[model samples]
Target chain A: MSPAEHLADAGLVQLLTPAGERVDHPVYSPLAAHLDGDALRAMYRDMVLVRRFDNEATSLQRQGELGLWAQSLGQEGAQVGSGHALAPQDYVFPSYREHGVAQTRGVDLANLLRLFRGIDHGGWDPTAHNFHLYTLVIGSHTLHATGYAMGVQRDGLVGTGDPTRDTAVVTYFGDGATSQGDVNEALVFAAVNNAPLVLFCQNNQWAISEPTTRQARVPLADRGLGFGVPSVRVDGNDVIASYAVTAEALERARSGGGPTFIEAFTYRMGAHTTSDDPTRYRSAAEDEYWRQRDPIDRLRLHLEQTDELPAAFATDLEAEAVALGERIRSTVRSWGPPTPASMFDHVYASPNSVVDSERAWFESYESTFAPTQGGAR
Target chain B: MTTERITFAKAINSGLRRALEQDPKVLLMGEDIGALGGVFRVTDGLHKDFGPDRVVDTPLAESGIVGTAIGLALRGYRPVCEIQFDGFIFPAFDQITTQLAKMHYRSQGRLTLPVVIRVPFGGGIGAIEHHSESPEALFAHTPGLRVVSPSNPADAYAMIQQAIASPDPVLFFEPKVRYWDKADVDLETPAEPPHTDAAPTGLDRARVLREGTDVTLIAYGPSVAPALKAAATAAAEGTSVEVIDLRTISPLDTDTLVASVRKTGRCVVAHEAPVLYGTGAEIAARVTERCFFHLQAPVLRVGGFHVPYPVAKIEQDYLPNLDRILEAIDRTLTF
Candidate 1:
């Protein structure tokens, strides 16, 4: 089939309008046609809980309960849409800012919080969730995703044309990732192998103080064209568009269409984290402009217009979100400092002598701390 | 299980071949690894056997190799990565030390970097300056890493398996000069008794090659061979010398070392790398302080001079050969 045929097969990237109207598109129709009212409502709930969790994690960081947090306040639609697009067995390799995707993959919110809270790296088992650990490196995760996709091909997990038999890999990175040498090399490795992988680039406008233009000379999707991989640009703010696009791309991958690059065009409404100040690099006016195209609001508006969700339901979700936020707070406080030896424990699968000695020294040292946590001392 | 014997390099090839056969998660990535079977023919014929899918050839980007290997590792694949040379490993050093080393810890134990970085290290290749150098100390010093050095063919065969089977990121230092040094290697017989998965060099302990009462000669990798020979020579001199091979360097096996020193009352450390700020000195200081009363004299060291390794012709002069080792042994006896 032709490249355009593949593009058309990928679906045009939407099912709902920004003003909450259900829309129709010939090309993007196939992927989202499967998402009935229940699915959209499910997507909405996933986004709300993830957002609330994101907010609480940020507060925990500020309260010194966490080391830091990479919030996904504005990129919820992109992550949730892509997260839901993946099947139970399909694997996901997420960059650090994929809280929304983790939620969609059924990762426990408390487990993810432990990472930033300095309690644990990540508590979820990849086998249980089929969602890999959060990768802190920028574009490097793509190489791994592509390599694993190559493994998928060898295992005959792709090109079987059977939905149950096929497994696709989705890796998340951002515009800043485009600059990394490993990212480009991943493209080389993936294209040469034709690994069944999807490279999802969330072009959230600014990477730290640098704009998208600084990293990419053209659109991120256009960058994939030279590698013979099919590419697309989606409305990251529109949950329906993000879902339909990712789902189509993943389907193409599973069916042996090779790798696809999706540029989720969105904006970072909040500072990079609570640590960043948007006022320094970006204009408040630009922030306001992206806020108008808010992904969650548009999805909520579509739900309200369809009467698929009631005012009472929205109120209840808001209340539920608050309670979810409270749960996150308690989880943070209850996650007391990890056992000090745990610091050196997982560094090696088996205990190496150097690490053991270090652990022993630390154990003795920590014993010196009497009643630091409670007043029982 | 049927038992088979092979050379050090062949043993590595067999280990990788089995990983590909048993688990789909095992993959090999490195330069010239696919078509050329690696610069040393260590991975020779692997590409033909497993095809290019399992054995990968990539552009010469060290940082990209390690940084991306971290990703592949994340995708539930145990990636066995090869650094072509010790000097070239520096380019990817940051990723190894910072990202791969701390990733699991930073993730708070949520990540298991079951990735193996196969590096050829140690001097005495009789080649260029960069080609001949012992850089294991650099990686051994890093936290969240297991640094291993294999002295003989059997150790090489066993250690590679252990390093790959590990859930942590391991720096497998293959003494470049000793890669071709053949020994009786039983691939079916594991490092441990009865179990096939015995760690190649075992875990974080020192092994005594020979027992003596006059003094202790402690070393590892290329230096171990000469230290053993030196101990034999010292035997003729009536100074029975005990030689200890430090398999894992970072932890230093202080318990074994202190015990040996306490018995011998004298110690002589040897290595191919420069002695200053070298593994020998670190061992010396640690042993001296920990076993001060037990020591007969300040821990005497036999190592390469404090300078960059010399040209090929003079390279042998630079490496601590048997003569230099015996000279140090004589000095310890005089002390």
Candidate 2:
């Protein structure tokens, strides 16, 4: 199946077409109606900024500044759109590539590089942004998200009728994660417990080297239906559709409608990471196909044609994107290794005798060596 | 103080009840833990008193049970997760090791997951495969996790509460064989609140169950019983054996173990896990390293064979029984 076939699949909820036309769906179009021209422009700006950050990180990896990078190149629409749909109290459990999602939560993008730079495991405080630290292991955080939603249920934050008082949880993953036992188990748990969660799957065409077809015989959205979750497929490249679909799911969850699974049919425009090589596995024609359907460009075109794009807005966003790229480059270069003894910190929340004793022994052992010139020792 | 004689299983149940009563945040989750009271009836009656929300009968999925428990903990709820059995914990190993254990460190101490994973461990229950096994060492080897086991009803009652109250993730290994073992427990003494500024003690420390002089026989969980029996038998032959029950596996009570070994000058560590790279191997290595000068003999170990846990009919031949412990003790004493 080609990208065109998947995009035109029946039952796909899309509020905008690939050619920058504003289309409508009886269900999801109403959800996106609240987003005025300004809101849509903000979403576009977010996608542009996050894409710039991602590209800079990729360059950093190539320059040997970072160990690796997971680019959210083409999937920015799905991320920014859904991310903007989140309420302040709604927590997020993101897979490693949700940089755009992290930006939506107001997380400093520079701090995220600390992990790739090998200075820290996860540099940001999750509670500060109501966004969990990026979970690297595939499908692992899905259960955590379900569990968090279950926590929301127990806290009486669901079905409160008052929008401000209710909360929901959203977890992001790729097509590959659906095959993981944890993901399927999470679906079962969320369904049976009636957890207020949105299992957002970005079917970004490939999981590293393997294509989505290798992950599932049926549409990825259909996987959730078996678990009793209301599943939907959306054109992930359509920002308006992504936003609307996510908003609807979040509303359902907040109103105690239980878990919903949204499969965002998208494409990974870049290599899986700096460590991956798409040339060996996929065709250039396919890459070009997705690039032409670029999430940022499509939104930019729609905004321009609709007269929502003020001339200043485009120029200002371009300058902002350049500034973000520069900030990331400088911040990543300035990062240094953490203190040697700091490795022992936070292994346990409280004092542990083994850690304390080992640390003491290490300090004494290090003291045996004379200080080297220039503090090299 | 109110005291009562109860089985180790009932003691754990009572301790869980107290934790649930004291803190609404603490909830139980496991397969069959609710209506079925778990496969071993360890959690019997908790669902009735606490309701399904509090004592959740989770799907028959170990990883989901633990993974969600981590999420709940992240949300400020203290989740007491049950792993059903020792062998069953392997499915959730990735979540427990990578996520649950590392979340605090990953968050740079900004987050704490107060999750207690109750795993019924050890052999000699004469059950089917995967039902009886001791996988505590695997958890103990991982950083950011507290692995502890109770050999008696008193410790079982107190330790479960302590594990649940802890700010760090704890692998509470229940000795399945000793679940029926009866002992007096002080029910009134509240479990030391983990958030308090008191000195670190209790479940993280080892207890000198029996005091002696000639040799120190150290064990934990199911082995503690046979160790005491070995000590008593050795006492008849005039060799005073000091038996140490390692209530905590990880962050081992090196102070107590080394002190005992230094006094006795001979040591024998025992457990139901295979001796090869088992908890006993760690105890032996640590005891030898710390008490190098005080040692009168090389440290010995008594445990199951390197082979897989055998069938119930022939499990005795593979298990570390009182005779095997005594033999190791005699070897250490005579050496």
Candidate 3:
């Protein structure tokens, strides 16, 4: 019916209300209680810094530095919360806009800019951080995550009782992806195989110009039941609830409890990407409504009222954010286009005569051109 | 050397069994592959021997089969997936071309997906639509994949193991019509895995099945036998013919084809797919380019009609047969 009505649904799990008050749930509160003052401060800092990084990238896109950029402006809580809940053994397959999750995975934020700048399809070593390269194709990586979970099962790494040896997988997508065949197929595979996976969906309420209602008649979380997967809906703007639900899901997965579908109810506070203009399709009133429930602002309010926000901590975070922006601006400017011949590299792992001959011919053909002042043309 | 006469399907089964035995990470995934042993029984005994884990009977979704195989490959497993028929592969085309083919290139050499997609391809099965069709040209045109097909039982046994051992993604197209054809397989001679630096032989080279001085005829998979038969028929009519079996599709073995064409001064290509933009056209263009100066005539092509595969009763008229191959050979000789 109404936007507020959707948020206030009884099925929504809210550990912290929008008014910055810490509420409790019978099952999830105990799961989230482990976040001490230090963990809370770390998560707050993550959201702030991620927002700063996203804003800087948007500016770069406007300045013609990046080809395109996808903003995770309102998804910091859902990303950072679930990201922080992951164990080292867990693997993550993220869609294109997961800057907060990337930060939590220790990925160098500069690597993300390489993709947007059109220098490379992916920029990080997935094995190094247990975070896969961002998949631009909608809902495609869900199957990859499901298959990886199957591999974990085949490797005898599930239900081992030893937490260090056990493994789980998490794949992130938006509500619109629930309509995709691959996503639905991933659910089927994960359920039938009883694979260790968590299908984390951020219902940001918009898939570009379309709303979630266009994608499904029922709540997105209900689709999981049809596939035999247990599911939960969380107040995605509440970081504590997101973290608690993800942690419990990961624990169940590691212990061979099969797949869990988590629908994080959130909003898109910005355009879908740099090329998109949300103003044409949505209302300013709705935008303002979501701005008041901004993930970073809500956490800031809670920390301030509790007196956990020291003056020095705020100052340091602001300085860090400024430095990160400068670094992003400079790093992106320094990267030049890759070598012309490098395009033929890595097309195949084994020897390919066709590629080899073509590369040789191309090199000789280019050599025919006279050298420019800088180098060969 | 130890030798045994077996059907083409049995050879592939033996090859798959050997690959499973050679490496612990090698597994099979497809519909009806387990318990039912696949619709064609190519994987008949594997599920019973390796159990359900190694030989998996997946859900009836083609995209899911390939997409999940990618994930399994990412986790350090070699997954050989079977697409039930030639026509059924279109459903998994996105995963094959976009994701599976480009994974290594996109990852900048950081990832290698050693997954093999086995499809029973080509016509003359006298079956329904989509069951008999040659779609190897589509995969061969893609840069990141290695496309191959086997004509006889021996090559089927050896090439399947080679495809499994390869570090790159391979599209193994099996000629379904010849699945029951019997031939002697040398069981004792283990095929050496293909090497990157060396010239390819076992899986990637073109072999001269018959030699002649007048014309060179090139064919692969199910069409190889017909080409050889056509060559024999031409020989009886006082025409010397050379036959070449192109085992690998993507690389084309230009060196071998060009050398033969240069020597013969004439060439002809034959296959089951449509002649328009088919594998035969590529072979003709490459042969012409390299052997242009030495050629006495343009390279001719013999293949299926440029239309939908005809019904089962009159399918013979639509496919390339001995008479068609002989006619094409005559045209190249006369020209």
Candidate 4:
């Protein structure tokens, strides 16, 4: 069978159907008690704002404001559900395309644009929010997250049974990163060490132009079973399932249940990046199929059916999204280029004579150029 | 001051022991470092002394070893990773260059990765193809990593501790061939003492092993010992050859190099790597730029041939020896 067919047969843990109906599984139904009318509405609002930010970022890329943009259009439920499931002490290591995860972590939406605007490598203090900088290199951050989890173990933070104090680590990567050696190695280390880690694989079904079938023959979640990690597959469009599964996994880690692999089965509804043309590699039929299961619309529909979301609330949310878009547009346009000497500021923690000498030489060389020409470049 | 005669391998072991004892955060991780005590036995008895927790025997994955070590550093632990052999380090090259080397810079100084990667480097022993190779130039070319090698037992004992204590990530390249060579090491002396009245010899500066006026022989790691031997042989022939052991390869102690070259008017760089795009090329470029008119002859380099490190039987022809170094010194004097 094809990889997609295998995933379909694998019996994904889903709490909500794609047609805006609430469902239940024997293992996951207990988690539905935590999602009241207010909580469900909050989750819907979170998805709407995250989509707004992602859309604004994509538009900025097309309008020549950003160097590049990776949109999280269809994967909002996967990101937001898992993001909201974390404890405040839990650390997050993200792949480059996690704009929704960044939103849930309280990162200033405008600051994240600095990376794509070419003004900074990473703009926010990762330590401030317990969310690490985005790793562009695929699959590398999984190992880092595992190691940090090991550190958490060493610090006597795990197995404490304190909901407010025990720590766990969550790492996000796409289906494409599963093919990297670093990711496989990370699984080995995490299993052997029994580190308190959760491997959140957002299986968006396409790694650039290649389909998920090209990367794996079995279900992606089953790959974790070989490494001794417990595996589960969740319908990523069902935010209820994503949040419940991740929350249970994080609790398992804190209570010394070791690492768990959670494959959030989702799809990419847009181009991989602003530079990619998805139409060349994929069929419109497939895109239309995934569009019917749009994560944001499904959550909004569920809220409407429950009468938890009023018309006034939807109108206010639309206005809030427009205001957010305008703020990002103005902020991006006002950012100036960094000084040339700023490049040498953080190469080493301790002073390096070689870098210092090179910085001085560069400053002297730049001085030799005419002010107009130098400033223009 | 107390001194002891020990092999270079023992000196490194002693250094690691001191580092582990001094700082509770320091830990060791490698493929066979725990029970096997490393292939070269450089980490022998460390696991017994510190237990398996401190000296960890990791899976046979080089990238995982390095990538996880960076994470451990982020948690405020100083991780000292071992890459088994010189050629085997390629698997972990991406982690070392892209992540470990750039983490501090990418985080804008908020994250400091105090990671030390210990690699057994260079060729001289009659080992297999991958075992005997010099790839120091590849690491030295990367920014944010401090690459250092010790030529003698003293520097091996002292420099390893300094590399671990460094706030920045450091690549400590151990000369596998010189592991058995012996020298006097001050066992009680801390490399960088907190209460020292005198300035300690730093890891960045090059040291003048022997002073001469006719020519200067500059080398690091395994090549430094051969350069010193070649200088001695040249001295017996009435040619004064100065020898400088470059403890740090990346920073390129050009001050000491230029001062010696200015006095001697001649220079020769020696290493086990190929001359093309090797550390020698960087030294030559900087020497020419700094001391444009000081030399009576152009800077010469003695290094491995532009070919793969040959098999056991013909390995001598591939590596630079004392005779080849002296031949380059003779050629320099003729000018």
Interface RMSD of each: 3.5, 1.4, 1.0, 2.4
List, residue by residue over A1-377, the lDDT tens digit for candidate 2.
66445444577777787779888788888898888899999999999999999989999999999999889999999999999999999999999999989999999999999999999999898999999999999999999999999999999999989989899999999999999999999999999999999999999989998877778778899999999999999989888899999999999999999999999989999989999989999999988888888888898889989999999988999999999999999888988888677788999998798898888887777778788753214
- In candidate 2, stretches whose alpha carbon ends up further than 4 angstroms from where it belongs are A1-10, A370-376, B193-201
lDDT of 3 by residue, A1-377 (tens): 65444445568898888888899799999999888878999999999999999999999999999999999999999999999999998999999999999999999898999999999989999999999999878888999999999999999999999999899999999989999999999999999999999999999999999888678777889999899999999989999999999999999999999999999999989889999999999999989999888888888888999998999999999999999999999999999888778889999998788899999998898799897753347
Kindly list the per-residue Cα lDDT of model 4 for residues B206-255, writing each as its tens digit. 88999999998999999988898999999999999999998888777788
State which candidate, 2 or 4, has the greater lDDT.
2
lDDT of 4 by residue, A1-377 (tens): 75558547357888888878889788877866678988887788888998888899999999999999998999999999888888889999999888888888989988889999998898899999889999999999999998888888878889998888899999999999999999999999999988899999999999999988888988899889999999999999889899999988898899899999999999988889999999999999989989999998888888888898899999999999999999999999999888888899899888676898999998888888777733423
Give one digit per residue, the lDDT tens place, for model 3 in B1-335.
Answer: 98999999999999999999989999999999999999999999899999999999999888899999999999999999999999999988888888899999999999999999999998887899888888899999898999999899999998999999988999999999899999999876787675443534567788888999999999999999999999999999998899999999987788899999999999999999998999999998998889999999999998987898778888888788898999998898777
> Order the candidates by lDDT, highest first — what do you get?
3, 2, 4, 1
Pairs that collide, model 2: none
RMSD of each: 4.7, 1.7, 1.5, 1.8
Cα lDDT for residue A323, model 4?
A: 94
Q: What is the lDDT of residue A89 in candidate 1?
A: 73
lDDT of 1 at B160: 73
Give one digit per residue, the lDDT tens place, for model 2 in B1-335. Answer: 98999999999999999999999999999988988998878889999999999999899999999999999998889999998888899999999999999999999999999999999988897889988898888888899999998899988998898898789999998989999888899999877654333634476788898999999999999999999999999999998999999988987888899999999999999999988888889988998888999999999988988898999999988888988988888888776
| Clash pairs for candidate 3 | none
Per-model TM-score of chain B? 0.93, 0.97, 0.98, 0.97
Query: In model 4, where do residues sit more than 4 Å from their true spots?
Result: A3-10, A370-377, B193-200
- The lDDT, on a scale of 0 to 1, for candidate 2 is 0.91
Which has the greatest DockQ?
3
Q: What is the TM-score of chain A alone in each candidate?
A: 0.91, 0.97, 0.97, 0.97
Worst 10 residues of 3 chain B by lDDT: B194-203
